[model samples]
Target: MQYKPLIMGILNVTPDSFSDGGQYCVQAEALAHAQRMVLEGADIIDIGGESTRPGSDPVSEGEQLARVIPVIQALRCHLPSNLLLSIDTTRSAVAEAAIVAGANVVNDVSAGTDDPRMFSVAARAGVPLVLMHMQGRPKNMQDNPGYRDVVEEVLTFLVERAEAAKDSGIRPENIIIDPGIGFGKRKEDNLRLIADLRRFVATGYKVLLGASRKKFMGAICGETRPVELMGATIATTVLGVSAGVSMFRVHDVKPNRQAADVTAAVLRT
Candidate 1:
């Protein structure tokens, strides 16, 4: 099979996300952005209602539902039936509601740690579950993230969570793991994770890289604005493709999709 990585377009419908916050908060805007991404070759659309930016406060489940469910419903009806919709939420209730509202995947950044019922909800829905490795709550995750070995620690954490999900009845093949770049990681830590992504890939579960326009990219490339980091993001996507990453969750779909495709083509040759 060709090694083309899946491109997961990010659609954060919150007023406070780090990047593109409030850009698609309205139903019409969200729908339009999603359509554009789909046209740009997004294999999946990850819709997030809450802002998980560093030092951000959590949104209530009711508020989250209000923000994301209608968007999911609209996207479900408007987009192709085969295009997967992923609800990026940590709360099981919100995940369940999104699933009922038409989402096909559960992307929990906390990896079933924030809500104990998350795995059960994914299992019940029989949807693919994304279990990410976040060191702490978004409010204080970046306060001072420390790890003896960033890659090994995150890898171990994700593996244990995957096992827990399997123990809770979630099928093994449906589980995907994310390293949670920038969520609770320092610049060096984030770089290390991206560089050593193959370790996570070696774990056998599909590995997702969400390093889209992250702060560390800015710190390295000297671009403070998130939107300006599309090139940097594409660089990471290409690096991720070479590292055997299966999926890329990104804000800019077209460029990263092109980069992944080109890189995969070159690698195959």
Candidate 2:
């Protein structure tokens, strides 16, 4: 089946990430998890070295590189050509090294604010760049994020960032925008973003919905563990696909792939 909403399996190589941290921090473990995701129908593998969970400290460049590059190299050598590899980072240096090591995309939660060189690296490599909107730096993003109108603000920020990336020599077609459901949003804001995802989709850029196992689900469902949120995650995947989202960044690939396939089938009729 042609995956309608491309499933980007999340592979956090950091030991302190919010979910599944330490579960795949070792090089061998990370590579094995990536291989499992690919076999489970993941179209893209997003590898991140640092923990972007709220209030997380930044990892040094050298450490981050050491964490992700080897796993990327191993996966690139092992996975088929069709499975895209994405380096989930905000640093330009990491993005460059990951691309050279065989990553096909740069998924930046900072949208280039963290590193000016990121745009040039992506442009030079000619790979797709995922620019996400975050109200503030991850360290203090969730510290009472406030907005007059969350959806409109997020949309405006993404449009401006997309244009800025285009102005910086990046191809328009190579840009993808994410509304950042939980990056700096409150529980209500995340719900609103998913409910009105069509506004982002209407921009004509490929919309990537990444509401996988976020804290908002726990707020709504009263579930504490990230793995327990799989049902909620699949629900959002189906909702995003119906709203025209082109991709989904998720932890559980098989369930999300199944959700996307069923949603695509329903929409085709």
Candidate 3:
């Protein structure tokens, strides 16, 4: 019942991120936010340049590269050298650039299905990578998606994809799996996956649950705005801790870290 939570702080450098959008798009603000989150208990900071919100269009690879590199450079130069830096992208070129700029983790929300080169990038980088499970492309994921059994299908996909990544030369220890709570799932599917997350951990790989501030939280909280779903986010973090989740991707770092600490304390008792 012990919790070893790997809190990956969200650093979305986009104009349309659900929260903290445009707020951190400026170089100075972004640097300050990264520093604060690391001080607030973020083991890692996930730097993403593109917005993958519902109905959002994809950014050009060149543009995406431009957005994240400078921020990563600042982080590498100013933040603690041991601070874990993650590039939240599926582009191999971006991955390579981020690594060369000193990022250590590659968090591909596409699960490497979008770009065939993703797995190979992780392999060559020799760093830990997170494979997030999403049903389809971000732009169309919420367009009336249907899955006969989301939990089963998602688990299968994670297993297959993890194996594929391993075969592509990524070691098992260098991999983490995320359920991708809102990408293509309804509220029910997300809940069931959280309830049954131990099955994923049983695979001997770490499971990182990223259900923070998602649309489902708004639906659960009956709020229209992303900021209003924070209480629900805390609840999900507690539930995730109860299920032995290894990491959490969140916008609210201090609250999530505190929730995790309390949950871990109770479970230990």
RMSD values for the candidates in order, in angstroms, are 0.8, 1.3, 1.3
Models 1 onward score TM values of 0.98, 0.98, 0.97
Ranking by lDDT: 1, 2, 3
lDDT of 1 by residue, 1-269 (tens): 77779999999999989989999999999999999999999999999999999999999999999999999999999999999999999999999999998999999999999999998999998999999999889999999899999998999999999999999999988999999999889999999998999999998999899999999989988889998999999999999999999999999999999999999999998
Candidate that scores best on lDDT:
1
Off by over 4 Å in 3: 1-3
- Return the TM-score for candidate 2, rounded to 2 decimals: 0.98
Clashes of each: 0, 0, 0
lDDT of 2 by residue, 225-255 (tens): 9889999999999999899999999999999
Sorted by TM-score (best first), the order is 1, 2, 3
* Model 2 local distance difference test score: 0.93
Better of 1 and 2 by TM-score: 1
